[model samples]
Target: MPSIPLPGFQPPESIQEVFLNPGGFHFGTTDTRIVTLLGSCVSITLWHPRLRVGGMCHFMLPSRGVIPEGAGYDGRYGDEAMKLFLGHIMRIGAEPEAFQAKLFGGANMFADMAQRCEINVGERNIEMGLLQLERYGIPLVAKHLGGESHRKLMFDVWSGDVWLKSEQGRKPR
Candidate 1:
């Protein structure tokens, strides 16, 4: 899909680019684009329309369950990733509500395993993202969640545009 450009915004001469790996997160200002590949993992993108600043996180799991204080934050976990995003928002003197969020990924790559397990990781990851967004009062403006194929996603922080392309023909049996 074509990206909808933000009004009154001019493209920067050079835009910073970031490719996030599983368990990774990135936050930056207007001239940034973050990309990631996903299967069962989930990614949350947050953008502030006014400031043209935001971040994205690729998390593999729902939670690590009450990490001990002083332990560093791990972007691998959904909860921790949200906290990481929050810390950055605060550091930039922005409120969580000022941001618009988008969610992607959380595909069921192992159908049989997911059915056999009590809780599916992909589903849990997606749920964790939704819960965290609500808990922080950040509005989730868009999402493409839960499927059988992998996905490649790109988020443009400058325009709050997210482009998602589903990788077809690889559904789990």
Candidate 2:
């Protein structure tokens, strides 16, 4: 196995590793894990009770329709990304009724620009995420959202333990 370095933090050595960069999602059972950084964007985790399987998505945009044509696929969009993440979990045998969600991020990092379009995107992302989860009948188990600082998240696929690291604080679930 190759060694991967994590800046300012120790990296774990394992056969299976999953890294979720900004605007990305990864779902699978592996000895490795999933990791991501969140700013104004929102990260949502959905896990199945029976299968112990789940996925995480970091989305930056509130909706996809606002993006212009030919912009390609923006995984950062909440609506688009959430659908894709949920669909992937479902494909792997996760039932909607059996899954619960955990959401984080949507920081008001751009507070100075509150009057600008950039400031409201974060709030919109959170709103759309909650609405979408409710629409799908999935209950939200926990959340650590809306603040002024970014976050670093690590999700252990094998154990389903989510570690949220942020300047504000850490919430483990």
Tens-digit lDDT track for model 2 on 33-148?
77888888888887765575678888888876865876655677888877786677667766676777889888877777877654566677789889879888888988888877
> Model 1 over residues 1-173: C-alpha lDDT tens digits?
55755566665679898999999999988889899999999999999999899999999999999898899999999999999999999999999999999999888888888788866788889999999999999998999888788989988787888888897754422
How accurate locally is residue 126 in candidate 2, as Cα lDDT from 0 to 100? 86
Model 1 spans with C-alpha error above 4 angstroms:
1-6, 169-173
Q: In candidate 1, where is summed lDDT lowest over 10 consecutive residues?
A: 164-173
**Runs of candidate 2 exceeding 4 Å displacement:** 1-15, 30-32, 66-73, 116-118, 169-173
Alpha-carbon TM-score of each model against the true structure: 0.92, 0.79
**lDDT for residue 162 in candidate 2, whole number 0-100:** 72
Please give the lDDT score at residue 33 for candidate 1: 87
TM-score of 1: 0.92
Give the best candidate by TM-score: 1
Question: Model 2 reaches what TM-score against the true structure?
Answer: 0.79
Highest lDDT against the true fold, candidate: 1
